[model samples]
Target: MAFDSLSAFLAMGGHGVYVWAAWGVTGLLLVGVVIHARAERRALLRDLRRRARRAQYHGASGAAAPPISHQEGRARES
Candidate 1:
């Protein structure tokens, strides 16, 4: 199929509104997915870094201690 002109093709036989709306939704969804993936990756890396630091500290001290948990702190208070 050939359009009479670029503008005519964009009009898409009077269905351009639906076509553009669908494209807009798809673009926004893709952007949201990319943002979420990046955020999750950053959080995972941060957690790994924290664990590595804790392990290194224990190794240097030559003492193996259980990980300190927030619950443990609260239990100590009680």
Candidate 2:
């Protein structure tokens, strides 16, 4: 089938409302997914950068971070 004009093509045999609504919903959902993915990626990158800065700061301070165990602390002290 061929459309005689742009309006007729969009009308889609008088089901234009339902067809356009479905298309609009699908487009909006796709855009939402893209936005969510970008936000998550940015948050992950920011966390990674913050962690790197903390590690660098600790290294530059010249005192090693203490061990987590009491036994290790006692042995080091001895």
Candidate 3:
């Protein structure tokens, strides 16, 4: 089919409202999902790096307490 004008092309035989609305909402949500996923990935990576740094610092500082066995812990407590 051919349209005499741009308005006629958009009208789409009176079903344009439903069609355009669906397309617009779906496009918007898809973009929002991409943005949200990127943000979550960055935040999680930052937290992981921070935890790793703390662990490295503690290991290098040599002030970390030593682990004790269960029997040793009971003997110490007694």
Candidate 4:
């Protein structure tokens, strides 16, 4: 099927209202999802950077981080 004119194409055989509304809602939802994901990723990265900074500060101060438990570390040679 071919649309011979722009107005007829937009009218979409008189079902344009439903079709256009569905398209608009889908576009809005897609945009919202993208924005939400970007925000979440930024927040997670910021938290990671903050922790890295804290670790560096502690290292520079010559403060030792807590040692891993022996059981969680290397096993002793039998």
User: In terms of TM-score, how similar is model 4 to the real structure?
Assistant: 0.58
lDDT of each: 0.75, 0.74, 0.71, 0.73
Query: lDDT per residue, candidate 3, 1-78, as tens digits?
Result: 577887887887798898889999999999999999999789668755665676687776433533333463365422
Greater lDDT among 3 and 4 belongs to 4
Candidate 1, 13-75: lDDT as tens digits: 999999989998999999999999999789668755776787787676424534445563455
Query: Tens-digit lDDT track for model 4 on 1-78?
Result: 578799998999999999899999999999999999999789668755665687887776423434334562254221
* The candidate that achieves the highest TM-score relative to the unseen native structure: 2
**Candidate 1: lDDT of 28?**
99
**Candidate 3, which segments miss by more than 4 Å at Cα?**
1-5, 60-78
TM-score of each: 0.53, 0.62, 0.55, 0.58
Q: Taking the tens digit of each residue's C-alpha lDDT, what string does model 2 give over 1-78?
A: 588899998998899999999999999999999999999789668755665676787776423444334452356532
Better of 2 and 4 by TM-score: 2
As a whole number from 0 to 100, the lDDT of residue 4 in candidate 1 is 92
Lowest summed lDDT over 10 consecutive residues: which window, candidate 1?
A: 61-70
As for lDDT, the candidate ahead, 1 or 4, is 1
Give me the overall lDDT of model 4: 0.73
lDDT of 3 at 45: 82
Q: Which residue ranges in model 4 land beyond 4 Å of their true spot?
A: 59-78
lDDT of 2 at 14: 100
By the lDDT metric, which is better: model 1 or model 3?
A: 1
